[model samples]
Target: MLDRIDATSITTIQLYNQPFIRAFEMTPSLPTFVPATQLPLAIDNGRLVLQDMLGVGAYGSVYRAIDTQTHQTYAVKSLNKAGLNSRQCAFQNHEAQLHAKVSGHPNIVTLHKVVEENDCLYMVLDCGMEGDLFYTITERGGFVGNTMAIKTIFSQIASAVLHCHSRGVYHRDLKPENIIMFGRSVKLVDFGLATTEPVSSEFGCGSTFYLSPECQGGFIESVKSYDSAANDVWSLGIILINLTFGRNPWKQACPRDETFSAYAQHNDFLQTILPMSTELNEIVKGAFCLNPKKRITLSELARRVQACRFFTTPEFPSEASVVSAATAASQASFSTTMSGVYPTSNLHGPDDKEDSGVDLQSMA
Candidate 1:
């Protein structure tokens, strides 16, 4: 189902199990700019008519747009250039380049084109009419008993990540908010924080709940670099938990978080606190392993996910027991040497705590 975009140069990259064709050429040089304060009703010389606002962010908003030429619909992400600093501008360019590299994958969002003008930058992408995974999960109250659905959705997401990795792209900010859906099909989006570097010293560069302990840093005092690929794997494990339960295992992955501390010390801690099957627990354990070198690779993870049939225990944990385990774990001794991070309010949907100083550079 890999759809190749029409491009001039075609190259192949070695994937974990096989070779993958990396199509899509580097985009043409950015076009000349025309300055203006507000979004244009028509862009690309009236080819696209901007419609309703789909969502809004600090620097920009996404709008539903229609191509007058093809009569096709798209989600246009419009960023206000006046609000972005030099570094932010560079990151925006980098995001487009990295996203283009991984665009052809079936499970990843297609970046149709990049348009710049009138004090703003616009990215025309496939519209996800069903909204994001966060809203979908919240509406359904998690995929706890839906094993088949979980398998299908998670596998697609994994495939998308694998595809990105095959292209030397690491999506540092991997979370439910960045995962959109068109019916049951998943599309990974937002590559502003993504990097081509296999390893990065950019600690605290992702959402708190999804970041690995290494990425969170502050444990050993001295600076340390982390494997970005492994960081992505760790985020996937958290995402799996969110899909199985309606909630996150913890607020953050750092040792300072009581819930995460309990899981780190005891192998069966997750089961003690939640209704998770041993089979699914093993997968989470592999992904959450403290040692980045030993964390399961994306290929191995995809294989395990495909093989796993059960994701939750038949009997759910009692409310009292869940509370008791959380209470006891609150007293567990964990490294107190960690940097202060804003609490990640909820995993399922957006909350008022978004601007509460997350450890990432930009949550675009």
Candidate 2:
């Protein structure tokens, strides 16, 4: 039976599921404060004329706004004051801090400035208009291309992940939605689920299907004791499988909550996802290894992806195909060269590896 939901009742739905208009209701009324050092923005002419709203989630709404002075487009993510006032403020603040710390990386979305309007926090980032990789791939007809194309796209994603890891940032939510593509390039977005250090206790931060086994266990207060980076690698592997097969690894599995656990314990689960390609199969298996220690690192994964045989394939004639072909060839070369230098076996095991070398203090 279709429930007769009214305008007032619509706001009760989760932000991700609600329409933009209904979700906008969740945004707190703007606060009045003089433009200060950290907060330099105002509702100029009574409207925040942004290019468009890219996405809205429990955390906030992401909009493409232009800097009038510089005339530069930027992604402005505004935190929902209601959610902030609730218990989620700490997580939101933590995410903002993480973005602030890793703001300058090319692969990572650049954070322009932070603003507080009406007690709500806003993060302005350099805008990328091409939308997310997930939507792009779906629009082009699921999983369209040769092995080389897959290798190239995966390598670009791996490079971004490597950048995050080098800085001790683990993108707990590594999926197509979070991967934005502009022209031929890709950038990682949505830091709401990212963390500088592992959550030792048991709190899960990512989407259900993409989350790692460890994250599904429970809530962990301390970030220093978990293998967050390794978890990110696992999610990346799942994403790779999805891209190659045009569907999730465990799409048919019952009870979505148990999917990760099932994948972690069974080799058949790995085998099931392998027919995509011998090379990509091995890469996914290594990344999805239940033992975090045994799983592949982003650096090694990047190398493996780059060196895959698919990269040697002939280029497609179309301009899009040509760009994809170039990206694949470049990544394949890098991966092959890197594999020789780092070697897959040298990666850290789940128990042996400590925190990533980067400091979390600044990110906090």
Candidate 3:
């Protein structure tokens, strides 16, 4: 008789190798590009011409291209024809259509058009030349400590999420990698995992680490089973922590047996970042609550952040200042803020309204 491997030993092995396993496990499979025949659009002198490949995903590759006719740059996302053939193309098409519908918001990446060419579906969006927040944070050596600057960025993201929620669009994936920053402005990109209806499956689409607790437990069971806008808020909270700490809060949590529920309830894990500001700590705790109902909504979170000790003071020089003084002050302020000046101001107008008509509704 052959010797049997002990289950307990296996568990211990998995726990010890959890980090490596998670890295491999969360990585999506490579996409299979559709045959050229499925591509319906032709590249001409005055049409679309592929510039460069930006990234690849389980669906397909994203290409940076130029529209010769309009002389405009765009990010063309091509869906793998092979995947489309096996899976539901309707959902992909729906995602593109929904993005097109709400592409007007400043904080949301604008979708120019969609064209089918050679068995591939190509979606054109404004190309962000400044790259994504992930790149910025990485290049800057982790977290940037400009409180006003960070709040400014978060406001833009919050505004986009709120707008999406109001329009019944749920962005299942919200992370720093999906947040593109151009100069001082930021926009939310990628809607591959977005839905206009309620998300019904507990183990639905999302990056593993960013997946909400409810989602990890496989609690979602129906198409209308989504947790409203709070899910996005939770992801945003995680993103905030990442930006603030320069790492994932659950980076040490093993993926094999440490489900999101267990991770959320562990107070020891929560206490790991006790050095963070009380405001930020509270924000993080409130957003990552195990119960979706307990998590604060995007509107409420935005208000809290805006009213926090950040975003109150003026950093840049005003337009009314004289040319020489304004230029000097602007340069100084920019340098100081960029170097890490945490301002404390309640950046709220007299009205202090919650939803300024920006929607964050789910598309599924």
User: lDDT tens digits, residues 325-362, model 2?
Assistant: 43455334322211000001101122332111111111
Compared with the true structure, what per-residue lDDT tens digits does model 1 show for residues 1-364?
1223322121111101121110001110111122333446788888998766655544666667799988998878777778678997877787788888999898998999999987788888887665556544543333545567677888999999999999999999887767876555788888867899998998876676678888977333434799989999999998887676645666676555555666666656676666678898899999988888899998898789889977777665452242334323322311112111111111112332322222111111
What overall lDDT goes with each candidate model?
0.66, 0.53, 0.56
Model 3 lDDT tens row, 1-364: 1223333232222332232211221121111244445443444333987755555544566666677777787777777555454446776687787787678999998988788766677777877765556544444333344566667778898999888888888887787667776556778877866777655454535665566756655332223344846678878887775555344555322233332324444533333322355566677777877567778778888888877773211321231122334334422433222211100011112332221110001100
Model 1 ranges off by over 4 Å? 1-39, 83-86, 218-223, 317-364
The order by descending lDDT is 1, 3, 2
RMSD of each: 15.9, 14.5, 13.5
Candidate 1's TM-score reads 0.76
Off by over 4 Å in 2: 1-48, 82-90, 218-225, 251-274, 310-364
TM-score versus the correct structure, for each prediction: 0.76, 0.66, 0.69
Error (Å) of candidate 1 at residue 212 is 0.6
